[model samples]
Target: MFGCIAAGRLVQTNLQQVDVNKYVFELSDPQSINHLVVFLLGTIPFEPGYAATVHLLWPNKDWQLLGGLSNEKPSAIFRIGGGKNNIMMNQPTATLGISIEPIETVQQLLSTLSSGVMKSGGSNLQHAVSMTEVGQMASRVIENLFNYVTSFAVQDLPMNGIALGEVTERGYLPVKAFQTWYNNLSRKLANDPNYLSSEKSA
Candidate 1:
C-alpha cells in the first residue's frame, strides 16, 4: 500500500500480493515524470542465507541492482534516479522490472560480464541502441508552474552504500555495483537539500 499527498490531493496505491516474487508497474506516458521514488515494506526474504538484492530493469535493457533488504530491515524507501545515475525514462516500450536475489551472486554475475567470462547473449546490448530509430522526439514551450517541496527523506547515503560495505568486506565489490552506488549518490546529493545546505553552511 502507498499513498502520496500532493497539492491537497490524496493518491493511494493498493496492490494485491498475487505473486510472491514479481511486481510490475507500467507507465504508458513518461513525459511528465521528472522524478520517481520507490518503497518496499514487509517481511522481505533473503536469498538462501545471503543478503537480498533488488534489481531494477528498464525497457531499453538498462538494469541496476540494489542490495540490503531482508527480514531484519523490512522497510526501504528510496528516491530513484536522484543519485549519480538518474532514472532512465521514456522509450518506445514502458516497463519496469523489480526482483530480489543474493548480493554475492549478483556481484559474480556482473564480474563475469566484465571479465569476458560471460559473453553477451547475441548482442542484446546492440539491439537496445536501435530502439530510437522510430522518431520519438519532442520540443516544448509555454508557461509553467512549479511547486517546490523543501523537505525530503535521506537514506542510503553512499548510493547503494549498504551493499558496498557488505560486498567489499565479504570479498570483492562489483565494479558495476560501486559505480551504480557512487553515481546514484552523486546525483541524489545534487538533488537533495540536506546535502546542499550542509555544503553551503560549511
Candidate 2:
C-alpha cells in the first residue's frame, strides 16, 4: 500500500509494484499535499552507506525536460518505533519526506523571475544560461535556489520539516518524485479556476 498524508488526511493507494523509471502519480491537488513520505519496501542489494542515484526531470518554461540526480545513501540504521519512518533491511532503507510547498513557491517564483528578466530588457532565461562546459550552471542555480527557498519554508512546517534526518533532505534530490507531484498539482489547479478561487477566498 502506498500511503501519504495529504491535506492532513491519510490517503492510501495500493499497488503491487512501481516501475523503476516511471512516474507513479499525477496528483490532482498540489496544495492539498503539504507533506510527502515515501518508503522503500524491498531490501537494498548494496551495503550500508551505499548510494543510489536519484533522478529528477521536469519541463522548464518551454516544457523541455530538465533532468537532475541525487546520490542518496542510507547512512544509519533507521528504527521504526524511534520516530524514524524507514524500515530496516539487510541493506539499510531510506525514507524521503518531501514538503511540496517550497517547490510550488519556487515554481511561481521562477515564472515571476522569467517575466522580470524579460521586462528588464535582459536576455531570455535560456540565453542567459551559458552553453559552455556542459552547462551545469543553470542546473546549479535551480538546485541552490530550491535549497535556499526550502531552508526558510521548512521553518514554517511542523517539526521544522524534519520527519527523519535523512528524510528532510530536499532540493533536487530524488528527482521526478516531487517534480511529477508538483506538476500534477499544477495541472489540476490550472484546469480548475473555480476551486483555485475558492481556495484563495477561503
Candidate 3:
C-alpha cells in the first residue's frame, strides 16, 4: 500500500503492523539524501473514510508529521537534506511511522502537501502530478531541485577558526580535514619542496 523513493532507488516498503491502525518502516540514510518521495501504491486506496498520516521520527523521539497520502492524492515530496529540514541522524538510517487512522489525519496530510509540493514563495522546481501520475515525477523533481542548489537554507560559518570534525554536519571545520590537509602540503613543501618528485600514495 506504500512505496518510497530514496536517492533514486525505489523500494516497496513492508509495513509492519505495530497497532491495529499504526504501521512502521525504516528509511535508510536520510542524512546523506537530498529528498524523500513517499506515495501510496494504489493497490489498496483509502476507503473514503479512512486515511494515512506519515511521520518521520525526530531526534528527540517525537513523531513529527512528514506528510500524508491518500486515494485522491498519492504522492508527496519532503526536503530531508541539510536545509530547513536539517534531519541529522545518530546512525545512518531513520524511522518512518505511518498511521492510517482518522479523517483528521487525511486533512493534515493534504493541508500541507496540497496537489504539489512546491507552492510558490520560492522557485518552483516540480509541478504537482495527477492521481494517474503518482510517483512518476520524483526524479524530475529531484533534478529540478538540484539546479537550485544555492537556494537551500544551508548552515554556514560566519567567520574562520570554527573547530569542526568530520562528524559535524555543518561545514565549520576549523582544523584537521582542511587545515591538516593544507598544512601537510605546506609542511611537505617546506621540508622537501620535491616531495611530489617521489611516488606517493596512489
Candidate 4:
C-alpha cells in the first residue's frame, strides 16, 4: 500500500488516478511542506513480482525519479522542498507520482538516476501495472512521524495547553513505532535543519 504525508496532512487518499497505473497527489501548500514521506501501510505487499516507484513533477521542470519502494523495503522519504538541497518552489502546487511496474523497472530507473538529475518522463512513465496500494492510515502515520517537529508550522503546537510531562506521557511518543526513530531526527532538524552538516563541518 502506498501513502504520503505532507505537513501533517494525509494525502494518499487524495491522490487522483491520472493514468493507467499512475496516481497523483495534488499538493496544495508546497512551501509549508518540509518533507514528503511515502510508505506502505503495514503487511500488504505489491502483487508478487512488482514494485512502486516515486517521482516528482514540477511544472516546466523535468520529471525526477525520487526512488522506488518494494516489499523488501516498503517505505521511502523524499526531501522534495523546504530543505536547503531541494527545490524551493515559487509556485503554489507540485505533483507527486506513485508508479506501479515490474521489478525490472527500478533497475532501469536507477541507471538513469545514477547518470544525472532528471529522466525522460515519456519513457519512464510509459510502463503500466494492474494495481497499486495507496496508503491510507499507515501513510498518514509515517508522514506524521517525520513531520512532528514541523508541528509548529500550522498555528500552535498540538500539546500546547497541557503540561509537558502529561503531554509527553499521554500523547507524544507514538504519534500519529516508526515514531521511535524519526521523532529523534525530526526534533534534531527542527532545532537545526543543518545539524548533521554542521557536525560534519566541525
Instruction: Order the candidate numbers by lDDT, best to worst.
Output: 4, 3, 1, 2
Better of 1 and 3 by TM-score: 3
Better of 1 and 4 by TM-score: 4
Q: lDDT per prediction?
A: 0.32, 0.29, 0.54, 0.57
Model 2 over residues 1-202: C-alpha lDDT tens digits? Answer: 1223233232324322345432243333332333333323223423322222211112221221121111121111111232222222222222222211222332333344334121111221221222211223323322332443344433233533433222243422232334444454456557874433342312
Per-structure clash totals for the candidates: 10, 2, 0, 2
Give per-residue CA lDDT, model 4, range 94-201, as digits (tens).
Answer: 788888888677657755663333222333322111112222223334544544533432333355443222222234322233334456656766987655444231
Candidate number achieving the greatest TM-score relative to the actual structure: 4
Candidate 1 lDDT over residue span 5-86, tens digit each: 1111111133323356545455333333333333342223544543333344555566654322333333233223422343
Give lDDT tens digits, candidate 3, residues 47-72: 66666777887556677676565564
Query: In model 4, which regions exceed 4 Å deviation?
Result: 7-12, 83-87, 115-202
TM-score of each: 0.33, 0.22, 0.50, 0.55
Cα error, residue 93 of model 2, in Å, equals: 28
Candidate 2: minimum summed lDDT over ten consecutive residues — where? Answer: 70-79
